[model samples]
Target chain A: MSRRLAAALRPAAAIGCALAAMAIALALLGASPLAVAADLADGAFGNWIAFTDTLARATPLVFCGLAVAVAFHGALWNIGADGQLVVGALAAGALGPALAGAPHTLAIVAIIGAGGLAGALWGGLAGWLRARRNVNEVISTIMLNFIAAQLLSWAVHGPLMEPSGAFPASRKIAAAARLHLYFAPTRLNLAMLFAVALAAVCELGLFRTVPGFELRALGRNRRASAFFGLPIARLTVGAMALSGALAGCGGAVQISAITHRLYETISPGWGYEAIAVALVARLSPLGVVPAALLFGALDNGSQAMQRADGVPAQLVYVVQALVIIVMLAFDAAAGGGWRELLEGGAPDRPDATAETCDA
Target chain B: MLEAFAASTIAMATPLLLAALGELIVERAGVINIGIEGAMLAGAFAGVAVAHATGATLAGVAAAIGGGVAINAIFAFVAVNLAVNQVVAGTAIDLLAAGVTGMLYQRIYGATGRAFTVAPMRPIALGPLARLPLIGRALFDQSALVYLAFALVPAIAWTIGRSRFGLSLRAAGERPEAADALGLGVYRLRWIALLASGALSGLGGAYLTLAYADTFVEGISAGRGYVALAVVIVGRWNAWGVAAASLMFGAAIALQFVLQAAATAIPYQLFLALPYLLTVAVLALMGGQADAPSALGEPYIRA
Candidate 1:
């Protein structure tokens, strides 16, 4: 029990230090750090509507975070989730207009399926390169992001372009295909419920299945897993494809729930931002929920920080950097100092191990 | 028509070649510097900002080198000493550089204004080499940076293949433990390689601001650094091969521009997507089971 308490406290202490350091930096930059923090709190939770907005913003983040966490657990770095999300949104957008006369339920299903398939295909390509050709997924995924961006730009500017054609975005999806809002006067829609359900499913799949065990084994040591007769190549590809599917679903949810249209910049690096979420969550499915919500709040409140205190929106990114650095630092220090702590009449081994695993 | 294509292709390929060559060297020495994008961005901003400030093109070029190296040093500390994941560290640096440069630009020049421009580097006549008809303009009549990019290909190839220092560097990358056992310093070689890569990548960034666009803009590197990374893979990790691959991509990009200029029925945006599309296609086809350095992404800690 004491060990568990220490494990929880260690991360909290590290985070506290990180927050204090960021506050100092913000103050040094001539911004009222306290005011910015206050604004963030107010914007995120000062009212019921504001809190709903935070939840709405967190919807896509939840999907992307889980997508990243899934692949990361398999030791596959699917960095192209951003590109996958865009492609997914593009496909869903196209499907919505084409199937406008279809039955409502059918139209929604088609749009979601189309988006997932698009993301899966994009992600599968990276897996194919990694498994068959030994191309680094990191390089391939980054390259694919540029390709996806260009494809969206072309689509919005050409074939699927809105009639006005002044901006690079597609026409709004049919009303029948849009996700219904569960809460009136807020952007919160069925997507949040879907995200929560998906998170629950992912948690089960990861912790309770044979495939999950294989994936965890692969992540821990591919060579050893292979020696134990796991099909490493197929697993890597499968994991990446599934990861992409989730990210694509994220895009579909965004289009149906909020945007209602396919814009060229559908995601403002939401897929990339998912990396931070997954990392902060230590790639745990259960952990991703709170991490995504926290990040969503930070992102949503950043504008308020800028408006209320003249703090640059870029300061959020600085905080994210500091968070990652501090997390890693704390994990390392805790692990290294564990032996000393144990000798000094404190139980530290389990806590140190947990912290290392989180990292 | 072919002559025009070839000329523009060479012009387009110059920056990629410079950047890819730098990345190839650093990767060859075992440090996967994902911060190439950040380095390039820094160099691009510094190059343009200095030229705008000093009005001397040379000063701008020098400042770009300084900027690139400065960014790279930060990455080296995080990745080398702190043992942070290289990809994460690199991404952070890229984000930091993007945000910082964007803010600095806005602070200095204000939001609503056209960026300052610099005089582009003029092509040098190679005297006898300039007399050749079709090939001359394609190869000889190019900026100093263009020629330097081409020259570095063979120079890097020779140095990596033959030099004593190159052997030590390769040893460090291939098997750091073995290299350490043999009394070679793994850290030092990686540091030197990163610095050299910074200079070359910085030059690549300078090419954009000083030659291509002749002005600064947000995200102006426009994923070129990442493209250079693909170029290294498509080039099969060889310096000469990297040069050839860069030229191919350059030609692809130049063709898109030409098609746009000619106002073809096909959307110009599709044309813009061609290079990236080709990069993926090339990787799919050619990147087959090639062996990377043993310690490519792992940081060495003395245990």
Candidate 2:
């Protein structure tokens, strides 16, 4: 078979394997594999609302996925996206009242920008520590996630507490700050377009720009990148900030377009799940779209499964986790990228095209 | 009030100390499992489920250890044998734990969430010592797990510091290939270290469900495992240091509880964030001084 065809067929085959595995697990748990599979499909794609829900879910995943993709490309791990997303929402929510009298378009832009800034700062904090103090990114980011969660809780319950003090959430965001919805009653909005546009921009910048070159070089080898005159510290921090900006944008868009209010808990582990999304996409900006959609389908279908099939919605996490394990293990074992996985067993292939290094 | 705070400090620190000790052992043997969070979660669920079903606290604790070891076995296979990326494998295990635990919890309880509780392990008093003045009950009156954890701190310190086996453990962590050449059996040592870590972490998880929280909730471990990682770092890879750091963190968390009870206008969330913020602050302050195992996180594959 031709390389492209084999590559295209690879993910489908891998996904099939994952599904079969999940089915066996389900069967052991006393649930019928066929019924759950049918339930998942019907829930994710059966109706217009479900389809819209999948797209809406995919929107945040795309932004967050890109966030991970960009950072991983630079060899930085932004595991704190959950925290960044929360901070983004916090920024946007805090700005809602101040923007109450502003023009609609300006208010929307400001809110989104604020969210991105908050996330950038949160993400940049980890980058700064890594570059300056040589602290590991993984532990730092995880700590930051905890801090962010507390901060969000405080914001909702204390400073931004609803006027009546009844709920741990902010007042509804100014109507003017809300994104224009494309589908009536469906949470879908122009944010989806923005997410895709930003992804396209990332794709171009990563492959076509000097800064992107620096980032990818750093990811490939820190010593080599520094040897080649890259401002290792600045690039490390900058790449982290940029990655965080995307995650912040996700938070901004979600608050502005969907929930329309900031609650105590803004995300259900979207930041961590985005790691799986980015990896499954091989950290490619373009690939993130389809990969995010797959995760999106799982999430959306999970809700359906819970409601109809009596399965817990968290089964989605199981599936995503499985995919991450298999994908990473596959990458490590084969010493190649997504294409290699799809190409069956091409051991001798150069790693030039592989998305993420084992490091 | 002071005694309550002191007692609570020990209670809160018990889990962190236990898990941090385990992680310190694993790191000393050249493996880093970020999935410590998942292992704790599995233990928590297993502990609660078994305790609830059998009405035996001891059985629940034992099951928790079994559950943790079983989960870590997967980590051992992928991270040790397959030699995959440790972070990815660890992360996958965490996600798997989250999913499977949630599914199991839901399967038992049904669609709508319901409470699952177990009788807490009764505290064991050091008879005469428990009656001492200020530090009496806080130190002498505690559960079996707390005593076990603190006792193991010294024991581990001795094992990893003075014993001949300790030399092999450090050798495995610092330079695995050399250790292998010396017939130190690097892989076997690493595997054993991980199993020990898993059992300790399982005990920590059991403490959360059966000793302190006395309940099962999704994500109940609540990043304690990660905090344990930070504790390991802040402790500078020493058993005594780990104990000190864990207690300091425990105090910080215990104060949060106190502050929340005080009902101050200060965003109570700020109080909640104290431990995490302290972790970052400690990392920043420790910088470079907090050395780690040289070969930590590298997957060992036989050539």
Candidate 3:
């Protein structure tokens, strides 16, 4: 088989296996897998409204998937994108209402920019720890995630609580800060388009730029990258900050277009879910769009499945997890190819030996 | 009030100690299972569901172990057999556990889940020791699981610090290739560590429902599993150190309830975020993996 065809088939096969396993689980639960599958398909793509809702659901995922891909490419294990997104939304939500007197376009830019900046700081903190303090990014990011969640909980209940204090939510942003829906009665908006544009930019930046090359090289072999004087610390911090900014912007867009206000739960684990998306796309920047859309459809459809078949919406999470597991297993079993790319060259490889010698 | 705080601290520390002990074993064998959280969640759900069905807490505890082992088994296959990235594999396991537990919980108990309570395990008082002043009941008069958690500290310390099996396990973690050369089966050692960790994590989860909360809730494990991971680190990869760190974190958590009840002007969220913030702060100060096993987090495939 052609390598390109093999590359394409691997993810498809993994998804197929994951769905099959879920089918067995559904059977055990006494729900007919076929019926559940049909319901999910119908709910996700049945009508124009459903399709638009899927798009809206996918918008944050696209941003998050990109964030994950960018960080992973630099071999930075950033598990705190969810926290970064939350802080970003908080920033946007806090600044949004104050932009009432500003021009509409300016208000939108400021809100998103604020979100991106906040996300960068959140992500940069982890990066700085890893670079300067030699702390594990995985642990720090996870801790940060818990901290960000508490911060959001505090914000909604305390400082950002709606004026009426009826709910644990912030006041809606000013009208000028909102991203206008392109079609009435549909959630279709410029945010999805912006997400797509960002994916294109990411694709270009990762493939066609010197910094991108440095990041990829760093990811492929950290010891070798350092030996080659690749400015390891700076690249690590920069990649993590950029990754956080992507997720943060996604949070900002969600506020601008969908929620319009901050709440205790601004993201439904989009940062974590994006890990599956990034993996399925094999960490390709451009591939994140379609991958996010697929997961988005699952999210949207699962609601309908719940209503029709008594299946819980959390079934999607199970599928997402399975996809990642199966993908990793398949790539590893296949030997070489994408596994090397994904793991950034295993230690036993020749390059690793060279790195050891250098050390 | 002071006695209550101490009691609460011990009770809270029990679960963290159990979970951290398991992680200590796994990390000592050269693998980090982020899925420890997932295992705990699986255990919590299984424990409550089984106990509720059979009206037997022991049965629930057994099921919790099985549930935890099952989740870790998937992680073991991917991270160990496939020789893939342990962190990513562990993350997937966590997601799987969360998804399966949440979906099944809703399916079995309904959306509102108002009927999901179980009779908590009765604390076992150590005869006359239970009546000795404030600290007595706080430490001695506790559930069998709580006592078991503390007892394992020395047991684990001796096993890892002095036993031949521990030497092999540490060998696997420190340098798998060298360990393999020395006739130690790195794969077997790592698998054993992961399985042991699974059981410990599951027991921790069971303690939440069967001994402490007396009910099951989605994400009741919260970030306890992750915190357990930090416990292993802050403990500096020593069993006794893990025990102390767990108690410190447990006290941090117990303080939340105490402070929240005091109703100070402080926002309750500040208290809620305390343990997590403390984890980051301590880790930052500790800095460097100077004491970490040499080959930790690396996938080793025999040549």
- lDDT, candidate 2, residue B175? 85
Error of 3 at A342 (Å): 3.6
Off by over 4 Å in 2: A1-10, A338-359
Clashing pairs in 2: none
lDDT of 2 by residue, B14-132 (tens): 99999999999998888888989999999999999999999999999999998888888888877787777676678788889999998999899765658767899999999999988
The predicted structure with the larger lDDT, 1 or 3, is 3
Give the Cα RMSD of candidate 1: 6.1
Residue A135, candidate 2: how far off, in angstroms?
A: 1.9
TM-score of chain A of each: 0.90, 0.92, 0.95
Superposed Cα deviation of residue B166, candidate 2 (Å): 2.4
Candidates ranked by DockQ, best first?
A: 3, 2, 1
Cα error, candidate 1, residue A184 (Å): 3.3
Candidate 1, residues A1-359: lDDT per residue as tens digits? 57657655664665577579878977776777778799988888888888989998888899889988888787676778998888889899888777777888888888888888999998988887787766778778888888889888888888898989788888889988998887788887778888889898889998899998888777666655656778777887888888898999999888887888888778888887787787677677877888889888988888777778756666666566656556555554455422221112110001122233445
Taking chain A of model 3 alone, its TM-score versus the true chain A equals 0.95
Per-residue error (Å), model 2, residue B291: 1.7
Docking tier of model 3: it is medium
Report the C-alpha lDDT of model 3 over B18-62, residue by residue, as the tens digit: 999999998888887899999999998999999999999999999
Q: Candidate 1 falls in which docking quality class?
A: acceptable
Q: Evaluate residue B22 in candidate 1 and report its C-alpha lDDT on the 0 to 100 scale.
A: 85
lDDT (Cα atoms) of all candidates against the true structure: 0.79, 0.84, 0.89
The C-alpha local distance difference test score for the whole of candidate 1 amounts to: 0.79
